[model samples]
Target: MNVSLLANSLVGSEIIKIGNEVNEMKRKGAQISNLTIGDFDPSIYPIPDELKEAIVTAYNEHQTNYPPADGVLALRETVSGVLKSRYALEYNANEILVSGGSRPLIYATYLALIDPGDKVVYPAPSWNNNHYCVLSSANGVAVETSVENNFMPTGDQLKPHLKGATLLALCSPLNPTGTMFSAEQLLEICDLVLAENKSRSADEKPLYIMYDQIYSLLTFGKEHVNPISLRPELRDYVIYIDGISKALAATGVRVGWAFGPEVIISKMKSLLGHIGAWAPKAEQVAVAKYFRDEAQVDTFLKEFKGAVQKSLDTLYNGFQEMKKEGFNVDAVVPMGAIYLTLKIDYIGKTTPAGDLLKNSADLNFYLIHEAQTALVPFSAFGNDESVAWFRASVGGCSLEDVYAMLPKIKTALSKLK
Candidate 1:
């Protein structure tokens, strides 16, 4: 049976495929330290007490009906207020659109702005920009990044591709790297985007930016920067994607938002409205109430950031120790997000059983067995499959879990000859 060409051509998530492999090992009673998925294990990191209680209360009050096409007005207003107070972003509620987590909002942004065959430029070793481009029939140009710049794409890397690109998909506290754009770094990119848009004719579609700042509040010491916040002039061309999934450790709650030019936002709301992807009404109501209490929000954030930081620090320090001990292992200083960029460059090395580690996927599987650990390789995020850099998500693990895996990693590396 033949299906639609788009359906047939769509590429599935490589991370999910690796996750399934980890699950199969776990089911067989393997003590696997699985760090493939970009989600929090609720047992390790639960949602805020105030927000959780509000969710229950809202349900009890029978707020389970269909939500407004755009979203409940109250939640939108709360989101606007939080952005204004925290980031100094002055978006009105009317410009905000709520959806189920950031995924739908991102997809809607692509569909709303990109026509078939348009170009979408994004940094590789980032998130799922490649798949989104495919879904929208846009030509995806992935700018490869290096560790010297903390795995972030620079203006020089992106300038050549900016000429005719319709969309520049960017994420800070970028998913796989756990690194963010410094103010000066992001300012340079913003300047480039501003110039590109300025060069476009009024009749032509201006180059737009889809800035994903979902992990903005999760930054350790570095400040999270956004395009509009850096260059207010680009506000009209920037669409922001953010939510509580990362900050609140509430991935399951499924409340996310996108705010930008009223024109693009209106079109996005229309697209998402037909798909009926509005966040659950009860969760939306609960989050709105949670946002209004500044003290409670700050307290929860303080505690939440501590837990996430502990795990990230454990991984970063552990890998550094290994690197100092002369192992072929290194990691980036985790600045933001729940990920640690791990470099285990063992390609062409021989494993204990004389099997050769040929690529990133091979290195991943070897660690799964030899060290009883699982990690998502950079190849999963649109990089070449042979790269050894991988993303270790700490959201699902505990401090003890990280420590226990350290010796296992050392022992496994020792076996490589």
Candidate 2:
């Protein structure tokens, strides 16, 4: 029999709908300009000479046997050092768990912290996984905060969800919206959790925090602030999740880590021991070396920052040009992260039965059939109730490609209106 509950609740992404439509149109001989990608574009950026050399050097030579269950010992130590270096927060190697990707690390943390019917707080327009992961695999509750407050959660705004939640899943430089809370605001939320925890006993439920900083270092003009930096004394309360996927553009490398209290990380590692166990021996060795050399890490950061900034600028200018051309676009320039969140409400729209069109999903479908463009709806990221919004992953597109897509974007938004 087919599985019921979480697995059954998992639906395919809404953006894929537009993408499949474009593919069908292309099959019918309609030319379509593609702007709907979420990963980095293929560019000829010089890969770190050392990492490349190491990959070749370490090939099959490393302990090719099943690596340690919690990941290679050396890699865990290196990740520990990285945590300390980045935020002056220290972690024992035992407190860090290696994972296939940040997604697994996130899912594993949810498994470790959450139980049936537990609530998990997330802001609207976040990484689609923030809620979907909880709902799809576990019997946890997904609570949505609005986009009106710039998508960052105020404690009061979040407390209702946080009330009985086993954990709070958060993303800085959020997914679709690319918004982040200030360092102080982050502490305020953490403080609220502590206060809330104080109201209960040690035997009572404790709400943990799974704070994702995968996009932490990729900020554009703004200071890339981290919450751990605010109050290192309370480190045990927060689980810091991150990986090389965003930093080194090594997404497929599938290397990520979870750093948190021994109790939480221990349980997560126990789960990983059964699920993914240690990372690939070679990749772990490579990432360990990559983390060890601070100079190399700094050099890589410098180059990546430049490339991502240029990409963000290209997106910024494209949206500005669209605004100038009379399209009502809400361009929230992300200071960091690899996406552009656009709200195109000016397009004239109506339902098929002639009812006025409403919400991002309606606009998304209109764009596909009429505009011949494919982009994910903001609702896919958990926005709801008539919020008309869209997101494009311009991480991989060139400035030229980004510019060329605007007319297509306008055409798509136009069809909906």
Candidate 3:
């Protein structure tokens, strides 16, 4: 059967592919420590009691109708306050657009800004910007970042690509790597972007930034920085993606927002409205009321981040121990988010079963079968399969699970020669 080229050419998420394989093994009674998906195991990281109760109360009050096309107004208002209080961002409700989750907001950002063949530049191993570019029919540029920069793209690395680009997709406490940009690093990039915009003609679409800070609130000790915060003049050119999904362990609740210039935001709101991608009315109402209490939000973050950090630290230290023991493995210090950047450079080795580990994927699967451990290779995040670095997401795993998997991974690597 024939299909639209876009539909036929669309690639599925690699993380979901690996996660499905692990889940299937688990269903077959395999004892696998699944670390593939960037989602919380609600059993270990439950949503705040106050927020959950608010959700129930909203539902009981019959707030089940379809939400406003942009989002519930009250939720937008609350999100506005959050911006002012948390990040010193002063976007009003009119400038905010809410959707079911950050995914739609991100997609909407692409659709609103990118014309066909327009260039979209993002750092490789960052996240789904490549796929989004495909979906939007834009020319995608994946700037390869180095491990020396903790996999975060530096201004010098991204400067050359900014010319003639329509959008620059960026993230901090970045997905897949759990690394962040220092203020100086982001400041440099911000200056480059400002200069790029200045170089563009007025009729030309200025280079816009789709800044995905979904993991902003989950940072361990590092402060989350934004392009506008560093360069307020860039306010009109930056759209921020954030929500309660990571911060409140409420991924299932489906509430995310994008704030930017009113004109751009209005277009995105119209796009989402046509798609009918609003968050549930009840969840929006619940979040509006629940998030208004700054004290409660801070209290929950303190405990939630503590648990997430403990798991990240455990995995980082475990991999460092293996490196000290002469295993072909290493890990970056946990900076933020629930991921630990890992180096499992055993791609050319042979498994005990005589299978040649040809690439990161092969090495990952070998560990899944031989050591009952699972991780996402950088290939899944737009890197080549030969890249030995992998992302270990600890959101779904407990500290005990992380502790137990280390020795198994070491044993599995030891058997590979």
Candidate lDDT values, in order: 0.92, 0.71, 0.93
**Residue 5's lDDT in candidate 1:** 86
lDDT of 2 by residue, 97-171 (tens): 888878777878877776665666666667755454545344444456655666677777777666656677778
Judged by whole-model lDDT over C-alpha atoms, candidate 2 comes out at 0.71
Q: Count the backbone clashes (under 3 Å) in each candidate.
A: 0, 5, 0
- TM-score for each prediction? 0.99, 0.89, 0.99
Across 1-417, the per-residue lDDT of candidate 3 in tens digits comes to 399999987999888878888989999999999999899999999999999999999999999988888899999999999899989988999999999989999999999999999999999988888889899999999999988999999999999899999999999989989999999999999999999999999999999999999999888888999988899999989999998899899999999999999999999999999999999999999999999899999999999999999999988988888999998889988888889999999999998788899999999999898889999999988899999999999999899999999899988899988
Error of 1 at 360 (Å): 0.4
Residue 304 displacement (Å), model 1: 1.4
Candidate 3, residue 292: the lDDT equals: 86
**lDDT tens digits, residues 242-295, model 1?**
998998999999999999999999999999999999999999999999977778
Segments in model 1 whose C-alpha atoms lie over 4 Å from true places: none
Alpha-carbon deviation at 257 in model 3, angstroms:
0.2
Model 3: worst 10 consecutive residues (lDDT sum) = 13-22
